[model samples]
Target: MKNASRLFLALIGLSLVVPVFADKDPNINAIKARQGEMQIRAHNLGPLIAMAKGKMPYEPKLAGQLAGNLKLLLDLDTSRDWPPGSDNKSYPHKTRALPNIWTSYPEIGKYGKDYATSVNELNAVAGDGLEALQSKIGAVGNTCKGCHDEYQEEHQH
Candidate 1:
């Protein structure tokens, strides 16, 4: 009975140590941070897209605010959130970023510049009128789609 009690105590001690010694993913936090940023982008862009589509009534004040939010997001320095080896291939289903995002280097920079251009244009005209918003919003959406098509895996429904 003493031996059985000692064995149980030993097993409990091992369980406590095992987790501390476990190989935890180092890139998980970076992946989550980047994902959160994208979610915020989508949250800000969604209303503007809806208004542009005429599905939602275009309120100039709201249009300007949402576009401003997207433009503000562009100013965030997110390089750390996109560290190498944090892609979906490395982290699997935890992320949708493809390995080519890192492998392709500055090739992706053009897409970013394009996105910025689109967002800036949208921001300038979003408060002007619904017609103005419609004209520039497509360009912004296209820039987003361009990057996602190249770097992000298709999100499964």
Candidate 2:
């Protein structure tokens, strides 16, 4: 009976371990590449935000271009297969994403939704001119900060 019990436990352990070593998903790699691209686009939003904050001179034409770019980036589907290294490996560019992001994926998705909403609103106002958009900048600015505060490292600028 003891031998039978030991055999049963060993099988159960293998059942759990087998999947971890299963073939890696190609979709995950594609998703990781897309995510890397979005990170670069996200970084570019800073200069536009700085202009709105009056840290730099505001150019309505440039603001419109930046706003359009932001809209495109925010509209991307960022959720794809969880990148492999995201679970355990930390890269130089990666911020230590909270583990809860994996457990609570829906909540993490809300941050993207919020960003999209803000970008849409910003784009509407920015289309007219910088002055028209300046007042609404705070709402959009907070959306960027809201996600980065949790998911990204602090930028010097």
Candidate 3:
């Protein structure tokens, strides 16, 4: 009985120490670089999305190129590749990312899905030709607004 009690106590003590001694990721630098790339690509995405929406004067060829770019960006595997904090950290980058993104991760993911859907819709319009592109531009813009409303900072345009 005494041995059992002592063993239990030892196990408890080890559990307490294990977390404190656990290693932190040493790959922060690599993570930051990947995050930076994500930000650059993400920033460019807005304009492409906008172009596809025909917010600017429409050229079918330009719209097609923008659609391709948007698809490329959407396809990037962020699971292991995207860095942390390079885009969202408060001081260094003036990112519009809302604090709620990390807090409400599920909702943020939903916004990502919505963004992809909007991009796909825009692509379809582009493929259909500029005549069908006008209203869909607003539809894509709404996705941007939805994401920004929840996940980004307000900007005065």
Candidate 4:
């Protein structure tokens, strides 16, 4: 927790010190921005899943920290970064976001709301106990898969 706080503070300080420049290409920048956010989400989620699956022992402090970090992400205003024409069809190998994300309109909004709901539910119980965390995790996973199924481009392994 102390490490996370220090990192967060350092990032905030760095942002203030660093010179801000407009992106030469907003489309590529937008794609990178949103993908970075998703990567952050996945980074926090991996450990929770590992503990839930018994691949790692459930540590309440770490569980809470991870879940808390996810909850913090909910405050980000990333909608403006997801401009149309920034998907896989346009960026090719640069992104897996399908064009449908923009065309689907409110359909994608529903998925976002579902994801927020699931994340909130999970955060509420994550530090309570292993059983509590497990109970709400499937809903969160389902929300992610639901969105990916509808909008993300599939890659063959």
Per-candidate TM-scores read: 0.83, 0.63, 0.57, 0.84
CA RMSD for every model? 6.0, 12.2, 12.1, 9.6
lDDT (0 to 1) per candidate: 0.92, 0.69, 0.63, 0.89
Candidate 3 per-residue C-alpha lDDT over 27-123 given as tens digits, one digit per residue, 9 for 90 to 100: 3444454558656656655665565555666667776666666667778776553234434554234354555666655667887798788778867
Worst window of 10 by summed lDDT in candidate 2:
87-96
Best by lDDT: 1
1-157 in candidate 4: lDDT tens per residue?
Answer: 9999999999998787653445567787788889899999999999999989999999988998998898899999998779988989888998999988888776899899999999999999899999999998888888989999999989869
Expressed as tens digits, the lDDT of each residue in 1-157 for candidate 2 is: 9999999999999989876665365544544565686676667577677887789888878787888888877666655545534642244444334445566666767887887898888877775765777876777779867986866555636
Using lDDT as the yardstick, the better of models 1 and 3 is 1
> Which pairs of residues collide in candidate 2?
none
Candidate that scores best on TM-score: 4
Tens digits of per-residue lDDT, candidate 1, 35-141, equal: 99999989999999999999999999999999999999999998888888888877788999998998989899999999999999999999999999999999999
Query: How many residue pairs of model 2 clash at the backbone?
Result: 0
Rank by lDDT, highest first. Answer: 1, 4, 2, 3
Q: In terms of lDDT, which candidate is stronger, 1 or 4?
A: 1
Stretches off by above 4 angstroms in model 2 are 1-35, 88-95, 151-157
Model 4 reaches what TM-score against the true structure? 0.84
Which run of 10 residues does model 1 get worst, by summed lDDT? 18-27
